[model samples]
Target: MHIRPEQAGDSHPIAELTRRAFARAKHSDGTEQDIIDRLRKRGKLTCSLVACLGTEIIGHIAFSPVCIIGAHNQHPQWYGLGPVSVIPAQQRRGIGKTLITQGLATLEKTGTAGGCVVLGDPGYYQQFGFMPSPNLTYPHAPAQYFMVRSFDSNIPAGIVRYDAAFDT
Candidate 1:
Protein backbone atom coordinates (compact mmCIF):
# COMPACT_ATOMS: atom_id res chain seq x y z
CA MET A 1 0.00 0.00 0.00
CA HIS A 2 1.13 3.56 -0.66
CA ILE A 3 0.07 6.89 0.80
CA ARG A 4 0.02 10.07 -1.25
CA PRO A 5 -1.76 13.37 -1.83
CA GLU A 6 -5.08 12.93 -3.56
CA GLN A 7 -5.04 13.21 -7.32
CA ALA A 8 -7.82 14.42 -9.61
CA GLY A 9 -9.00 10.92 -10.34
CA ASP A 10 -9.24 9.93 -6.68
CA SER A 11 -12.33 12.01 -5.83
CA HIS A 12 -15.09 9.52 -6.60
CA PRO A 13 -13.14 6.63 -5.16
CA ILE A 14 -12.48 8.56 -2.03
CA ALA A 15 -16.17 9.39 -1.67
CA GLU A 16 -17.22 5.78 -2.05
CA LEU A 17 -14.57 4.63 0.36
CA THR A 18 -15.64 7.26 2.85
CA ARG A 19 -19.28 6.29 2.55
CA ARG A 20 -18.48 2.66 3.17
CA ALA A 21 -16.12 3.45 6.01
CA PHE A 22 -18.63 5.58 7.89
CA ALA A 23 -21.80 3.69 7.12
CA ARG A 24 -21.99 2.17 10.57
CA ALA A 25 -19.96 4.66 12.54
CA LYS A 26 -21.60 5.52 15.83
CA HIS A 27 -21.34 9.27 15.26
CA SER A 28 -21.54 9.68 11.54
CA ASP A 29 -24.22 11.96 10.11
CA GLY A 30 -24.31 9.99 6.86
CA THR A 31 -23.05 12.96 4.91
CA GLU A 32 -19.31 12.59 5.22
CA GLN A 33 -18.86 12.14 1.49
CA ASP A 34 -20.99 15.16 0.68
CA ILE A 35 -19.00 17.23 3.12
CA ILE A 36 -15.86 16.49 1.15
CA ASP A 37 -17.53 17.45 -2.08
CA ARG A 38 -18.81 20.70 -0.63
CA LEU A 39 -15.42 21.46 0.87
CA ARG A 40 -13.77 20.96 -2.47
CA LYS A 41 -16.35 23.12 -4.23
CA ARG A 42 -15.85 25.86 -1.70
CA GLY A 43 -12.08 25.59 -2.03
CA LYS A 44 -11.76 24.92 1.68
CA LEU A 45 -10.19 21.50 1.53
CA THR A 46 -6.73 22.47 2.58
CA CYS A 47 -5.25 18.99 2.57
CA SER A 48 -6.64 15.76 1.21
CA LEU A 49 -4.66 12.52 1.25
CA VAL A 50 -5.41 9.03 0.06
CA ALA A 51 -4.08 5.62 0.93
CA CYS A 52 -4.01 3.24 -1.96
CA LEU A 53 -3.22 -0.37 -2.65
CA GLY A 54 -2.33 -1.06 -6.26
CA THR A 55 -4.62 1.27 -8.19
CA GLU A 56 -7.48 1.31 -5.72
CA ILE A 57 -8.01 4.06 -3.20
CA ILE A 58 -8.72 2.42 0.13
CA GLY A 59 -8.63 5.30 2.58
CA HIS A 60 -8.86 9.05 2.72
CA ILE A 61 -8.36 12.02 5.08
CA ALA A 62 -9.13 15.72 4.92
CA PHE A 63 -7.95 18.85 6.72
CA SER A 64 -9.56 22.25 6.30
CA PRO A 65 -9.24 25.68 7.82
CA VAL A 66 -11.31 26.26 10.96
CA CYS A 67 -12.29 29.46 12.59
CA ILE A 68 -11.78 29.93 16.31
CA ILE A 69 -14.52 32.35 17.28
CA GLY A 70 -13.32 34.52 20.10
CA ALA A 71 -13.13 38.11 21.14
CA HIS A 72 -11.37 38.99 17.91
CA ASN A 73 -14.04 37.35 15.73
CA GLN A 74 -11.61 35.71 13.30
CA HIS A 75 -9.02 33.17 14.35
CA PRO A 76 -6.96 32.18 11.35
CA GLN A 77 -4.27 29.56 10.87
CA TRP A 78 -6.09 26.83 12.79
CA TYR A 79 -7.44 23.80 10.94
CA GLY A 80 -9.98 21.04 11.47
CA LEU A 81 -9.24 17.37 10.75
CA GLY A 82 -11.94 14.91 10.23
CA PRO A 83 -14.08 12.51 8.23
CA VAL A 84 -11.03 10.29 7.95
CA SER A 85 -12.13 7.12 6.27
CA VAL A 86 -10.70 3.68 5.67
CA ILE A 87 -12.70 1.10 3.76
CA PRO A 88 -14.34 -1.56 5.95
CA ALA A 89 -11.98 -4.16 4.55
CA GLN A 90 -8.97 -2.04 5.40
CA GLN A 91 -10.04 -0.69 8.76
CA ARG A 92 -7.61 -1.15 11.67
CA ARG A 93 -4.77 -1.83 9.26
CA GLY A 94 -3.14 1.60 9.90
CA ILE A 95 -4.26 3.23 6.68
CA GLY A 96 -6.18 6.00 8.46
CA LYS A 97 -3.33 6.52 10.84
CA THR A 98 -0.82 7.00 8.09
CA LEU A 99 -3.10 9.39 6.26
CA ILE A 100 -3.57 11.48 9.38
CA THR A 101 0.09 11.52 10.35
CA GLN A 102 1.15 12.48 6.86
CA GLY A 103 -1.63 15.04 6.50
CA LEU A 104 -0.69 16.76 9.72
CA ALA A 105 2.96 16.75 8.69
CA THR A 106 2.03 18.40 5.44
CA LEU A 107 0.09 21.11 7.29
CA GLU A 108 2.87 21.81 9.78
CA LYS A 109 5.40 22.05 7.03
CA THR A 110 3.34 24.88 5.56
CA GLY A 111 4.54 27.12 8.42
CA THR A 112 1.19 28.91 8.46
CA ALA A 113 -0.86 26.54 10.56
CA GLY A 114 -1.04 27.20 14.28
CA GLY A 115 -2.82 23.95 15.09
CA CYS A 116 -5.29 21.26 14.06
CA VAL A 117 -8.46 20.04 15.74
CA VAL A 118 -10.33 16.75 15.55
CA LEU A 119 -13.57 15.37 16.90
CA GLY A 120 -13.46 11.69 17.56
CA ASP A 121 -12.49 8.93 19.96
CA PRO A 122 -10.13 10.30 22.56
CA GLY A 123 -8.23 7.04 22.78
CA TYR A 124 -7.43 7.07 19.08
CA TYR A 125 -6.63 10.75 18.69
CA GLN A 126 -4.55 11.04 21.85
CA GLN A 127 -1.91 8.80 20.36
CA PHE A 128 -1.35 11.53 17.79
CA GLY A 129 -0.76 14.19 20.46
CA PHE A 130 -4.36 15.42 20.38
CA MET A 131 -5.88 16.31 23.73
CA PRO A 132 -8.95 18.05 25.05
CA SER A 133 -8.37 21.51 26.36
CA PRO A 134 -10.62 23.76 28.38
CA ASN A 135 -9.26 26.56 26.26
CA LEU A 136 -10.84 25.28 23.09
CA THR A 137 -14.34 23.98 22.44
CA TYR A 138 -16.75 22.93 19.73
CA PRO A 139 -20.34 23.80 20.43
CA HIS A 140 -21.84 20.97 18.43
CA ALA A 141 -20.05 18.15 20.19
CA PRO A 142 -19.01 17.03 23.60
CA ALA A 143 -15.92 18.87 24.73
CA GLN A 144 -13.99 15.70 25.54
CA TYR A 145 -14.49 14.32 22.05
CA PHE A 146 -13.06 17.45 20.52
CA MET A 147 -9.27 17.42 20.55
CA VAL A 148 -6.57 19.80 19.49
CA ARG A 149 -2.94 19.49 18.49
CA SER A 150 -1.11 22.76 18.35
CA PHE A 151 2.13 23.04 16.46
CA ASP A 152 3.22 25.91 18.64
CA SER A 153 2.94 26.79 22.32
CA ASN A 154 -0.36 28.58 21.94
CA ILE A 155 -3.71 26.84 21.91
CA PRO A 156 -6.28 29.58 21.53
CA ALA A 157 -9.38 29.85 23.67
CA GLY A 158 -12.63 29.86 21.70
CA ILE A 159 -15.31 27.88 19.94
CA VAL A 160 -14.06 26.04 16.88
CA ARG A 161 -16.29 26.45 13.84
CA TYR A 162 -15.78 23.91 11.12
CA ASP A 163 -16.32 24.67 7.45
CA ALA A 164 -19.89 25.29 6.27
CA ALA A 165 -19.72 22.06 4.36
CA PHE A 166 -19.89 20.28 7.69
CA ASP A 167 -23.39 21.60 8.03
CA THR A 168 -24.52 19.43 5.13
Candidate 2:
Protein backbone atom coordinates (compact mmCIF):
# COMPACT_ATOMS: atom_id res chain seq x y z
CA MET A 1 0.00 0.00 0.00
CA HIS A 2 1.19 3.49 -0.78
CA ILE A 3 0.92 5.96 2.11
CA ARG A 4 0.28 9.65 1.57
CA PRO A 5 -1.14 12.72 3.25
CA GLU A 6 -4.91 12.82 3.10
CA GLN A 7 -6.23 15.30 0.63
CA ALA A 8 -9.54 17.13 1.06
CA GLY A 9 -11.14 15.02 -1.65
CA ASP A 10 -10.42 11.83 0.29
CA SER A 11 -12.63 12.80 3.24
CA HIS A 12 -15.79 10.94 2.27
CA PRO A 13 -14.09 7.64 1.48
CA ILE A 14 -11.99 7.94 4.62
CA ALA A 15 -15.09 8.50 6.71
CA GLU A 16 -16.69 5.43 5.23
CA LEU A 17 -13.53 3.39 5.69
CA THR A 18 -13.25 4.46 9.32
CA ARG A 19 -16.87 3.64 9.99
CA ARG A 20 -16.58 0.20 8.47
CA ALA A 21 -13.22 -0.53 10.04
CA PHE A 22 -14.35 0.07 13.59
CA ALA A 23 -17.91 -1.08 13.24
CA ARG A 24 -17.15 -4.33 15.07
CA ALA A 25 -14.16 -3.35 17.13
CA LYS A 26 -14.07 -4.37 20.76
CA HIS A 27 -13.75 -0.84 22.15
CA SER A 28 -15.37 1.15 19.42
CA ASP A 29 -17.53 4.05 20.50
CA GLY A 30 -19.36 3.72 17.17
CA THR A 31 -18.54 7.35 16.56
CA GLU A 32 -15.07 7.16 15.07
CA GLN A 33 -16.35 8.70 11.88
CA ASP A 34 -17.91 11.60 13.73
CA ILE A 35 -14.74 12.21 15.68
CA ILE A 36 -12.76 12.48 12.47
CA ASP A 37 -15.30 14.84 11.05
CA ARG A 38 -15.23 17.00 14.15
CA LEU A 39 -11.47 17.04 14.22
CA ARG A 40 -11.24 18.07 10.59
CA LYS A 41 -13.94 20.69 10.87
CA ARG A 42 -12.03 22.25 13.73
CA GLY A 43 -8.72 22.22 11.84
CA LYS A 44 -7.24 19.89 14.43
CA LEU A 45 -6.14 17.16 12.06
CA THR A 46 -2.48 17.93 12.44
CA CYS A 47 -1.26 15.13 10.22
CA SER A 48 -4.07 13.15 8.71
CA LEU A 49 -2.96 10.43 6.29
CA VAL A 50 -4.27 7.65 4.12
CA ALA A 51 -2.98 4.23 3.10
CA CYS A 52 -3.93 3.34 -0.42
CA LEU A 53 -3.57 0.81 -3.19
CA GLY A 54 -3.33 3.05 -6.23
CA THR A 55 -6.20 5.55 -5.90
CA GLU A 56 -8.31 3.56 -3.49
CA ILE A 57 -7.98 4.50 0.14
CA ILE A 58 -7.84 1.52 2.46
CA GLY A 59 -6.57 3.00 5.73
CA HIS A 60 -6.49 6.24 7.66
CA ILE A 61 -4.75 7.76 10.71
CA ALA A 62 -4.91 11.10 12.48
CA PHE A 63 -2.95 13.27 14.84
CA SER A 64 -3.93 16.42 16.73
CA PRO A 65 -2.60 18.75 19.37
CA VAL A 66 -2.84 17.64 22.98
CA CYS A 67 -2.47 19.64 26.13
CA ILE A 68 -0.17 18.66 28.97
CA ILE A 69 -1.57 19.93 32.22
CA GLY A 70 0.90 21.64 34.52
CA ALA A 71 3.58 22.25 31.94
CA HIS A 72 4.25 25.47 33.90
CA ASN A 73 1.97 27.52 31.65
CA GLN A 74 4.27 26.99 28.74
CA HIS A 75 3.14 25.91 25.32
CA PRO A 76 2.79 22.15 25.15
CA GLN A 77 3.61 20.90 21.71
CA TRP A 78 2.32 17.38 22.32
CA TYR A 79 0.23 15.37 19.89
CA GLY A 80 -2.23 12.52 20.26
CA LEU A 81 -2.41 9.66 17.75
CA GLY A 82 -5.60 7.86 17.46
CA PRO A 83 -8.61 6.54 15.55
CA VAL A 84 -6.33 4.67 13.18
CA SER A 85 -8.32 2.44 10.92
CA VAL A 86 -7.84 0.06 7.99
CA ILE A 87 -10.73 -1.49 6.07
CA PRO A 88 -11.78 -4.88 7.45
CA ALA A 89 -10.85 -6.65 4.20
CA GLN A 90 -7.43 -5.03 4.39
CA GLN A 91 -6.74 -5.75 8.01
CA ARG A 92 -3.43 -7.44 8.97
CA ARG A 93 -1.85 -6.47 5.69
CA GLY A 94 0.30 -3.93 7.61
CA ILE A 95 -1.71 -1.05 6.21
CA GLY A 96 -2.48 0.30 9.68
CA LYS A 97 1.10 -0.15 10.73
CA THR A 98 2.37 1.60 7.64
CA LEU A 99 0.09 4.55 8.29
CA ILE A 100 1.30 4.77 11.88
CA THR A 101 4.96 4.53 10.97
CA GLN A 102 4.52 7.25 8.41
CA GLY A 103 2.47 9.49 10.71
CA LEU A 104 4.85 9.22 13.64
CA ALA A 105 7.84 9.84 11.41
CA THR A 106 6.11 12.96 10.19
CA LEU A 107 5.44 14.06 13.76
CA GLU A 108 9.13 13.72 14.58
CA LYS A 109 9.90 16.15 11.80
CA THR A 110 7.67 18.86 13.33
CA GLY A 111 10.19 19.32 16.16
CA THR A 112 7.56 18.29 18.67
CA ALA A 113 8.86 18.69 22.20
CA GLY A 114 6.23 16.68 24.04
CA GLY A 115 6.22 13.79 21.55
CA CYS A 116 3.15 11.60 20.94
CA VAL A 117 0.63 9.54 22.89
CA VAL A 118 -1.78 6.76 21.98
CA LEU A 119 -4.41 4.73 23.79
CA GLY A 120 -3.91 1.35 22.20
CA ASP A 121 -2.78 -2.21 22.77
CA PRO A 122 0.64 -2.44 24.31
CA GLY A 123 1.59 -5.43 22.22
CA TYR A 124 1.21 -3.51 18.98
CA TYR A 125 2.28 -0.01 20.00
CA GLN A 126 5.32 -1.12 21.99
CA GLN A 127 7.19 -2.00 18.85
CA PHE A 128 7.09 1.66 17.89
CA GLY A 129 8.75 2.71 21.19
CA PHE A 130 5.48 3.58 22.97
CA MET A 131 5.59 2.61 26.63
CA PRO A 132 3.17 3.06 29.49
CA SER A 133 4.02 6.36 31.12
CA PRO A 134 3.28 6.56 34.80
CA ASN A 135 4.09 10.25 34.84
CA LEU A 136 1.59 11.10 32.10
CA THR A 137 -2.04 10.13 32.36
CA TYR A 138 -5.17 10.23 30.24
CA PRO A 139 -8.22 10.42 32.47
CA HIS A 140 -10.01 7.09 32.90
CA ALA A 141 -7.75 5.28 30.51
CA PRO A 142 -6.24 2.00 31.64
CA ALA A 143 -2.74 2.79 32.78
CA GLN A 144 -1.16 0.13 30.66
CA TYR A 145 -3.09 0.97 27.52
CA PHE A 146 -2.39 4.68 27.53
CA MET A 147 1.16 4.97 26.24
CA VAL A 148 3.68 7.52 25.15
CA ARG A 149 6.80 7.72 23.05
CA SER A 150 8.71 10.76 24.18
CA PHE A 151 11.14 12.40 21.83
CA ASP A 152 13.31 13.65 24.64
CA SER A 153 14.84 12.45 27.89
CA ASN A 154 12.68 14.72 30.09
CA ILE A 155 9.23 13.32 29.59
CA PRO A 156 6.45 15.65 30.68
CA ALA A 157 4.51 14.59 33.75
CA GLY A 158 0.84 15.52 33.81
CA ILE A 159 -2.64 14.76 32.60
CA VAL A 160 -2.96 14.52 28.82
CA ARG A 161 -6.02 16.26 27.42
CA TYR A 162 -7.19 15.75 23.88
CA ASP A 163 -8.93 18.54 21.99
CA ALA A 164 -12.52 19.70 22.46
CA ALA A 165 -13.25 18.00 19.16
CA PHE A 166 -13.04 14.81 21.21
CA ASP A 167 -15.63 16.11 23.65
CA THR A 168 -18.43 14.52 21.76
TM-score of 2: 0.95
Which residue runs does candidate 1 get wrong by more than 4 Å? 71-76
Clashing pairs in 1: none
Model 1 residue 53 CA deviation in Å: 0.3
Number of the predicted model whose lDDT against the real structure is largest: 1
Task: Kindly report the root-mean-square deviation of model 2 from the true structure over all alpha carbons.
Answer: 1.3
Q: Candidate 2 residues 29-57, lDDT tens each?
A: 88988888999999999999999898899
lDDT scores in order: 0.90, 0.88
Score every model by TM-score.
Answer: 0.96, 0.95
lDDT of 1 at 155: 87
Clashes of 2: 0
